[model samples]
Target: MSPAVSPPDARLPHRDARRDAVVDELRRLMARVEGVPKGREGALSFGLSALDQHLPQGGLAFGTVHEISTASEADLPAAFGFLLALLARTPGSAPLLLVLASKKLARCGLPHGAGLAALGLAPSRLTLVETENAAEALWATEEAVRARAPAAVASAIGGKLDLKASQRLHYAAREAGVPLLLLRPGETESVATAATRWRIGAAPGAQDRFGLLAGWRWHANLERCRNGEPRAWMLEFDHATHRFSLAAAVADPSLARGGEAPSLRRTG
Candidate 1:
């Protein structure tokens, strides 16, 4: 007699059951890896109540890496400016470590002392680390984060960044209870473990009677955020306050002079 064989239709139930088991196991593993925060103790507020509400734990979480990138090459300056603003918002007075690749600096130019001061980050409180390449820059950033010396760490490394590298940095930040800010110019998607990812573009700034731009403005997109949905906002930086506010709400001389303001629309 021929060995008994299950018919294709009969095998369907077993296959379906196995698939469900695999899916359930995968979900459990993901949950274990992406552990939820216990509380809001490490949260860093954006100072905007509405923005804070959109972030996980009522604000940007510390002890994790937050990636910042530009919407395009042209927006690199805007993204860097935004990163400085965030550094100014870090909760402590410890010196900030800023790691930059030589190539990136050569291409984008160096961070200006005046600009840093304008963002409320005193140039004296920042430590600069120049690396030969992206890998070196990442290594320096990881070291700074692990040391737990800086109030916050930031790196501007433009080149290939893999998921594993990003995860390593994330783990270091978490272990040291420090926040790592990664500036990925040109906006690549290789970074996987960041607590949040922001994509920025230059927004029309408030102008004076002579058409000179005032405070920095950017169209920011929260592309990826854990525990929160993606959102976009036109934000303007208040140099004196080291805070962010809606661009439409900022007092614009042009607006007072009958210039139409940008619409505040919810975008992706």
Candidate 2:
């Protein structure tokens, strides 16, 4: 009998290498223009290998804008929890700026202090600013970003955030070497200037032997990435460490096509 031959590998190593080189060059140019340093210092790793490995800079890049939106009105709390988790991971004691528009406040209400502590965020570390409208919220966020005083700036503004406004915020963040975490309405049009955009939905969490709940869980869908692939994951935030980890690989039907709202089961 003739010897059986193995098929050649189908992966295109050369193509991937070329693409990575181009991305690196672009990062260098952007670093020069933005006056921000290049390399690992400029990114914030999620501490989850599955996620960090897929990011262009190995994590969420600073000196830029990252947008997050809820899957539905009910998911606003989960989205806010996710934001607090992100802020908790930031490497600084500097006061965090949270700008909110009155319209959004009336719709979603304010963040709770006890919830902040439960999410590994210190209430004293956050500075809250409530604006009368979306315009004022955006203005406050832009000025805060330019000031470079806060470790990060978060804005929960309700309205149509056009590309130009997003670009201005992006540039301000870049110049200040800080991050602008913008929370948009679920149905708002996506902004192009954001380095990455996420849509977060509430998800079922794990239970202990006695059927006790484990931690906060969310369905995170990476809708857009400037230099990476779009993906989704079931994430759990550890309140103790303020880090994210992969939840059990339970299939979520709501994460299916067309972006349907997830039917979240309350643990309490």
Candidate 3:
């Protein structure tokens, strides 16, 4: 009977099943890796361990657009300062182009040269462009990013950005291989194509070595990230160093003082 054909090699089916399982697992692993937003290769590091590790490519991705919005009018400076801090961390001497809507400028006033200098940004290195409205501001921003003349392009808009406009800016920034920073009002939150969305609010002010008021501190909420989890941290900007440092967590006032807690500022 030809030795019963060796029972059709029953173990062969089990071996084939195991091989298929291994192949399936490999495919799944590859899909997960590809799903991560790698940003641009050679991305700039934020220099803060807490923040950089959570960002795609282990840092802020160049050639992508990022959004920063304030929690209130009071938080505007913090948001602007945060953006400047990020720009300072970038590895280039190329000038930065700042586009502001006329309405926003009229309301928030112009950024002080001395304040920017304190943040390590030279006044001469900045070029300000005022536009009649948000639309024009966005257009100018796109042009600036497309030109790739500046190391970065930043725009301040007072209204919501539709998906179409956001997509246009995103594409332009990617094509030019430049970073784009968008500052929107606190209440203007809406869907957009930004690679990352940050909501910044004023945190407790930092104290000097003598325990006196020092530089500004901000609570940056990573509200949206393409391939990162949402996380929040208290960041202190050192004017002298032009670097951001993680702030120590604050203790609950009630727990520390055995009384009602001091009211904390609301942060979006």
Candidate 4:
């Protein structure tokens, strides 16, 4: 008798292949509908592969507002460092304006030219504006954005801003087609019309290429995004280059070679 024909294998891998194909097609369709501009006249890249993928328009929106806040007073420097790194990447020779509330300045101290230069910013290219309070600071930031004189506008507030105030700044930035960065202190979160919101704090120890203490590492959380999911990243700011880079997620402590972790140092 002829051998009975064996039944076709039931565990063939084609099932997975078919599922993957369907998923890929869905992603393509979603991207087409959601993808934002990427080149000049669009958004700015954060220079990190992980982050750009999650941001609306594939990067930070240019004609919109972004917010950054610290978890505590100690984290303020790291948050500010992250902002400075973004300013360093702004595309233009045009000076940028930094508006600060007088109360905020008294508490956080003024930004120094030398310190900014160390972070790859041209001190001369930064125009400082001081206001009496958060309300005035917000107004100045809006006006600066409307003026379009500076390449970007950044405002620092010592306290929280109401939703209406935040919306006004958002509209002004959009109207002028300039980016606006709002920096706030402490843990308070408010309803703001920002394209993205970030929470930043100091990370564990970080070492340079030579295994020596180099710069400060930060835990940056993408708290909110208009077109993407929230995510966290380990970001490092190199004093030598003043550029932000993705830090290794894990490292062997033994490789540090017995050097003590250095304190976070600021220039100026």
lDDT by residue for model 3 (1-268), tens: 1233455677878866888688656644553454322434445677877678667546666777788888677788778888877776667788898887846436767788898888878888889998888888888999999997998888888777888998889888777778888888664665477778888898778887899876678877777777655656667877678787776553232332331212122211
Stretches of candidate 4 off by over 4 Å are 1-41, 102-105, 209-211, 250-268
The CA-based lDDT of model 2 is what? 0.77
Per-residue lDDT, model 2, residue 175, is 74
Candidates 3 and 4: which is better by lDDT? Answer: 3
Q: Which stretches of candidate 1 lie over 4 Å from their true place?
A: 1-33, 36-40, 208-212, 249-268
What is the C-alpha lDDT profile of model 4 across 1-268, one tens digit per residue?
3433665577446755777688656654564444322332456678766667667555677777888888677888778877877887788799999887736335666787888888888888888888887778877888899998898888777676788888788777776778888887674775468878888888765776799878778877777776566656667778887766777652222332232222111100
lDDT of each: 0.76, 0.77, 0.73, 0.72
- Ten-residue region with minimum lDDT total, candidate 3: 259-268
Per-residue error for 9 in candidate 4, Å, reads 17
Off by over 4 Å in 3: 1-40, 250-268
Q: Best candidate per TM-score, number?
A: 2
Task: Give per-residue CA lDDT, model 1, range 1-268, as digits (tens).
Answer: 3443666787787877888688656644553467533342376678887688777556777777788988788888899898888888887678999998846446878888997898888899999998887788888988999897898899987887888898888789777777788888885764888878888889778665798776678877787787666776778887657778877653452332332222222231
Error of 2 at 167 (Å): 1.3
- TM-scores of the models, in the order given: 0.77, 0.81, 0.77, 0.76
lDDT per residue as tens, model 2, 29-122? 7656655555424676788887887777677888878899988888887888888888877777999999987464457667889989988889
Give the TM-score (vs. native) of candidate 4.
0.76
What C-alpha lDDT does candidate 3 achieve relative to the native structure? Answer: 0.73
Judge candidate 1 at residue 40 and give its lDDT: 21
